[model samples]
Target: MKKEILNCEKARSICIVQTLAKLGHFPNRKSEKEAWFLSPLRSETQASFKVSLKLNRWYDHGAGIGGNVIDLVCLIKQCSIKEALHLLNDESIPFTTEAPVSYPDNSGIEILSVKKLQHPALLDYLKSRGIDYKIASRYCYEVNYTCKGKKYFAIGLQNRSGGYELRNKFYKNGSSPKDISLFKTNQTSLIICEGLFDLLSLLSYSPTLATIHDFLVLNSVAYIKRTTKLLTDYKAIYLYLDRDNAGRKATQYLLTQNPHCKDMSNLYEGFNDLNDWWLFQKQQSG
Candidate 1:
């Protein structure tokens, strides 16, 4: 195909909904402003990926990444930015051979119960993100909660202060006493991450990484300063923060404070975070 070379701004403005429809990925449900579909990225039953008709963007809640036509194509086709632009220019190509297949529980969510990881739905959510159930089960719990009296369940990562970082397809919420989680490896070397999924991605990538190094998962990059005291404990600190403005600032601040700290985020340069990188790798590998 003789692809038209389009710039990013122009490529992003392409009608995403129209493009997906042309690709045979019509949404399973629709509204005046938004549409939902089973993610064309992976095979699943229920729809979690959403397309904003007004904003002209797509967000896959399961994978926690979203963007315009160009970004969606990059993920769907597992291609580079330039390749995504080329594919975007060619509308005749329907990438998917098969058909692609949220929740309302608002403010003041309550934790009803916590149990061992066993929910089929939750497991499927993890699978969609390229995380192994066994690895997740080792550190997380199946937390049943309620919001506006509606019952729900999610994968919960507990912190040292007895709080949980709650995540489901529909929402990402944190329980009381939000704090950093530290996994002691009794080793002087440390691997620091920004979120639960990213930490899990490291373990999924190679369990040996954790075996040889301790891990610190900051609930938020705002808590980056909290690690100052702990920084001196490790001889080598490898940072795996998000590749965003705040994460960049945090990484820069940490690198300055702890001379031993190194930005490992460069390893996943194009990705927003480690889990996103891991998901891309897993998808490409398949």
Candidate 2:
């Protein structure tokens, strides 16, 4: 007896955008030929991911990586290439099975709606951050909610617990049930970062890094210990944390734990963090 897997060609023929929906995802924007989404593998405020309906290609602008359906599954599920093939080959199975959100946090935040990312205010906010709406809308939502007797809205990045990590130009807060964000590739290399901006900045420079490497985004340095347990499984780990005391302490602690860990803060030396360095580069280039 022999096991079977989806041939590369078969997997390539499947509709990329439809697969995204099947995996509890949908595009934020779409046109005749293409659809845009926030990269599903990691949390993002911009729609940096795209799927070509006509060509059946997918790309993530922030990460700068793209491919067909097989590549999409491999990246989203953080599974191996072989695993993606087998998963895609099975039509009877639900796409990328996810457990129900356990103990979600509403925290007095009343969610009004979650919809395709659109709205001038949110788009402008993303632009101010040097992110494109075309990219941010993919994995993020234009979320409207009420809290403290006031109505407000922002870009929402859903957590594993079904709560949202909310952000905007003036407002920033998590709805509840905050947790770490992980981009698992089951790869030998891991890229660790302190917050969302730092992770996005790194991905903008090297899109293939996530595909080739793995990611453990603390979302806060509080999750540093969570990463120590993960490091034992990787062949190499890169730390892209901030240049402050907490970040430094976390980096030092990880270094003592794993010989393969490398601190990449020097890449953004003289700056607050990776995003600041990236923003400065953009200014200089202009």
Candidate 3:
């Protein structure tokens, strides 16, 4: 019965934005990727909660929690996961899989090859970022692909959705299913980074730190809403976002939701980001 319920939840996973609308909670603002709504979880006048149309996930910024359709139902209905599934199964509530959501098309991007990160260009790129090739290899690869009829290659870091976030000296992009990359250590604490390079820089700075705490890399700040759901299980969340406006806002948003969230950006003060700070240190020391 549990297996059947889980399968049903996966198969009938509904678009959360539509669900919100059905609940009479329309978004105040929306875009191609996400929608912002006044959080239904609490009495918030400001629309801080958001729903990712492509990912079919919702994050309640006020509550610092998020999840899939089942999780959302569970929260709103104050029921168990099993009860949430039952509620979703009711005929009165409509859950359709036909809604069109704007997501990146990966069909144009063909991964021609993937191998060890031994390419000199990629190694040099890592060196330029002050990240060790050895550490990078553990989490990244040399990916050769063609997109829009042009051939390209880069260091690829795979996200939880099985898509690659590619980076190099000249290109920074990702394949379809853009999602977060979670490195779990079975620990209660987590270090959240805004980009893959920052995660790599931290690992390179202290290899032992990887063993003590987990890490989450959001390929883009646009996914910060989706991140709130993943962070609920952790007792501590350390933010290492960029020093830019978007990064600062995201950090403040998360800190508002999760009081335990600590700002680690101070460690790299005066630099644009963690990787930039690490590179500057390496250049000065060398």
At residue 235, give the lDDT of candidate 2.
91
Global local distance difference test of model 3: 0.77
Per-candidate TM-score against the hidden true structure: 0.63, 0.58, 0.63
Please give the ranking of all candidate structures by lDDT, highest first, separated by commas.
Answer: 1, 3, 2
- Model 3: per-residue lDDT, tens digit, 160-273? 988788888755556666688898869999999988899999888888888789889888777888887877889999999999887899899899988779999999999889
Model 1's C-alpha root-mean-square deviation from the true structure amounts to 12.0
Segments in model 1 whose C-alpha atoms lie over 4 Å from true places: 1-107
Clashing pairs in 1: 38-101
| Local lDDT at 4 for model 2 | 70
lDDT of 1 by residue, 133-239 (tens): 88899889999876434566889988777777888765566555557888895899999898989988988998778579988998777567778999999999999
Candidate 1: worst-modelled 10 consecutive residues by lDDT: 99-108
Candidate with maximal lDDT: 1
Give the CA lDDT, 0 to 100, for residue 160 in model 2: 56
